[model samples]
Target: MKKPAKIWLWVALVLCVCTTGLNLSEGRWLSVAIAIVSIIGLCVLLFGQRKAGYIVMCVCAVGSFVVGVTQNMGELGAALAIVMSLIGSALVPVITGLFIKSQWKELK
Candidate 1:
């Protein structure tokens, strides 16, 4: 992975850890679990298992999004949560993926 890709992965890892901590403090078990999964996925990416990490991250992102939507269904607050999770959790892997693709192209 290129420097930029590594940086993104690091950022994602940090965000996942922070989110997990926050969820734990607030007693949100499900959210914490999702963050933990995301952290593991980010670690896998950092360790050079790019495809596996990407898959893991994608699954976690979608899982979180679904949970957020279902849990908050029929409420404006829930809608907000869904949007935030989509942006926060989903954006990380996407940005990392973009950097990875750019690095691969550069290599070629």
Candidate 2:
């Protein structure tokens, strides 16, 4: 993968962690803002590969939705969020691998 793409992916991950941490602290608005920005950052990285981008976007979106539901919402929301986050987290590595492979393909 390109250096910039790797960097951006890490940044997204950091932001994801930050948002989740903030959520636990009840900083809902801040968490949401960070999540939104990270999602966009992920999009910028998407230019490298549409399929990778779409996968990452879906994962991040689902993760965000789960987080939103879990906090200060209700049991239903929490359950949904938990499920989505788990699924998203599981898919993240696969999408990242695809991104790296796509980058390598371009390099050839």
Q: What is the C-alpha lDDT of each candidate?
A: 0.75, 0.56
- The TM-score values for the models, in the order shown, are 0.81, 0.36
List runs of model 2 lying over 4 Å from the truth: 27-57, 66-108
lDDT of 2: 0.56
Off by over 4 Å in 1: 74-79, 103-108
| Per-residue lDDT of candidate 2, residues 13-99 (tens digit) | 665666557665775664466466545646555544444554446555655655555653474466676665565444544455555
C-alpha RMSD by candidate, in order: 3.0, 9.2
TM-score of 1: 0.81
Best by TM-score: 1
Question: Candidate 2 has what TM-score?
Answer: 0.36
